[model samples]
Target: MSGLLALLDDVAAIAKVAAASVDDVAGMAAKAGTKAAGVVIDDAAVTPKYVHGFEGKRELPIIWKITKGSLFNKLVVLLPAAMLMNAFAPWLITPLLMLGGAYLSFEGAEKIFHRLFPHADHEVEEDMDVGDPVHLEEARVRGAIKTDFILSAEIMTITLAAIPEGAFWMEAVTLALVAVAITAAVYGSVALIVKMDDIGLFMAATARTGFGRSLGTGLVKGMPKLMVFLSTVGTAAMLWVGGSIIIHGLDVLGWPVLYDTIHRWAEAVAHGVSEGLAGLAAWATSALSYGIFGLAFGMILIPLVTRVIGPVWSVLTGGSKPAAH
Candidate 1:
């Protein structure tokens, strides 16, 4: 009886430890998820455009497919690679993160470039009209998944960095929690954004009161504006997060001039302002400077990317395999 009681006590102690670990993982995942907000917003913003021009029936199906691909990217491909990075080449994470930051900056600048030089955009009409839509969906889905892999990689890396180093199991569980939470948040939000119009239409048709019907009508009209807002927010987030990453990464790498200079200048400018507002002003100024830097670097890379890198890569691969396996 005493031996059995001792074993029971040991089992209870083990269960308590397990429960604590679960709580730790959940806590880390939520905190880390918040850190990846920029990418999450961009993901939600960017996905709806892929569904554009598809028949209504196909839109949800496409989203579902892409969502699955995203899950696979995070869970199957990215999670394992990130684990290896942590295990073997932990030092490389910051530089890899910085490179991804540059990518976000480049994309953000490219969006600005498009707005400033709309004529330069090679419209996708021809590509959209590919003879076999089945093939097109597959291609688009493949492209989106590849894109998601990059963004998700960036997100996961940021999450991993945010978390404290614990036992291997602790880190693994934390990452898994982050992966599942982020995937759910990004795609769930995307689904809601995509389906709001349909929901509004249903409400408009079925609502009993004039106000309810008008509210539904308003929701129908509001979706486009919401999308525009989402895009604007996404672009801003990309710039902010990208620039912040570059600054933070440089600091971590011991090249701190750009990072310090921006803060110093912002603080100097903010001194005349109210104490509470001063911090806000300084932060905004620093962010703006970083964002401008990101934009300049991105714009410079764009031409090089298109003219030199694109052609060379195309020659090497025999087609545009930029996002191909």
Candidate 2:
């Protein structure tokens, strides 16, 4: 009887440890996910555009296909790469993260530049000219997946950086959990945003109540504006997160000028404000400083990318040159 009781106690202890591990994984995943929020928002914002011009029936399937591709990118490709980096080349993480930050800065700046000085989008024109719907869909899907791979790399790297140093299994499990959760959140949001107008139309046409019909009508009208708002927010986030990453990275690498300057400015602003709002003031000041620097840095990169890198890449890949922005 005592032997059986001892075994039972051992089993309960094991179960308790397992439960604790699960909680740890969940907690780490949530924290890591928040760290990658800027990329996540941009992913959700960018995806719906890929489904444009497709039939409503096709939109969900396209999103599903992209979602599956995104999962594969994170799990099969990026997660392994991230693990390898952690194991063998841990020092590369910060530099790679800074590279991703630069990309985000360039992207956000390009969007703003295009908005300020409009240019014809040759890529969209090419898509419009494609005769075969099936081919166009395939091309768009491939393009989106390619784009997702880069963003997924960024997300995975950010998550990996956010994870506290721990056991190999714990880190692996945390990354996998973060991968699944982020993919679901991003693509699920994309699916809903893409289909919202259809839902609105259905409700408008079929709802029995007057309020329902009005709400449906409002949704239909509001979706475009909502998309624009999301895009603007995503761009701002990209710049903010990217700039912050670069500044912090510079500090880590022994170039603390930008980082220290930003902090000093934030501190000054914080002290100038009431105690209740000081923290908010500091954060706002820091963010604005980072964003302004990011915008300036990105602007410098624009001509170099378009004029030099774009042409070289096109030549090397045997692809058409990118259109000037």
Candidate 3:
């Protein structure tokens, strides 16, 4: 009886520890996930376009394919690379983060240019025409996977940077959780966004009542506007986040003046508002500044990327490349 009681005590204690660890992981993952929300928003906003021309039936499948690729990017490729970086050259994280920030800026700026010019994507439209559905699907999947790798690198690095140092397995578990959680969040949103039109169409045509049909018609009509809103928000977020990262990176690298100046300006402007509103004002002010900086950087990069980097890449690849569709 005594031996059994002692064993029970040990088992209970083990269970308690296991439960605690699980709780800790959930807490950490949530916090880290919140930190990465800016990128997450942009990722969701941008991904649906890859399947833009596909048939209705193919949209979800493409998203699924991309989601799988995104998982592979995070779990198989980036997760291991991040762990190795943490183990070995942890110092490289900040620099790599800066590079990612630069990329975000470039993408954001490119989008802005596309909007301003209104024909910037003409080359892409011209290139993307496909005859074979299978081949087109494969190409889209490959393209999305490649894009996801870059975004996953950014997401993982952001998550890794958010985490405090802990046991190796703890870090791994937190990251894996983040990976799966983010993938579900992003692609799940994509699936809904893509299928919404269909749902709306179905309701418009088949709803039993007028109100239902009107609601469905409204949804069908509103989807385009919603996508526009999402894309706009996404671009702004990318620039803001990228700019913020660069500023923070600068602060980390012994140049705090720019960040401090921006903060002070934000606070000063925010002072005119109510206390709660003031904080929001300050944040928005700072975000705007960072976004402007990102926009400038992106503008500079556009020409360089198109004229210099593209040519160089083309040469290196011996002219073999994605159709840019």
TM-scores for all predictions: 0.91, 0.96, 0.93
lDDT of 1 by residue, 1-325 (tens): 9999999999999999999988988888888888788888999898876776667788889888998998898888888999999999999989988998888888888888878887533334544565677888887777788789889999989988888889898888888888888888888888788888988999999999999899999999999999989988888888888888888899999999998898888989799789989988987898789788888778887887768887898899786635411
- Deviating ranges (above 4 Å) for candidate 2: 128-130, 320-325
lDDT of each: 0.84, 0.89, 0.86
Per candidate, the number of residue pairs that clash is: 0, 0, 0
Candidate 3, after superposition: displacement of residue 302 in Å? Answer: 1.8
TM-score winner between candidates 2 and 3:
2
Best by TM-score: 2
For model 1, name the residue pairs that clash: none
Candidate 3 C-alpha lDDT tens digits along 21-65: 999999999999986776888889878878877789888888988
Off by over 4 Å in 1: 265-282, 321-325
- How displaced is residue 8 in candidate 3, in Å? 2.4
Among these predicted structures, which one has the highest lDDT? 2
Worst 10-residue lDDT window for candidate 2 reads 316-325
Q: Residue pairs in steric clash, candidate 2?
A: none
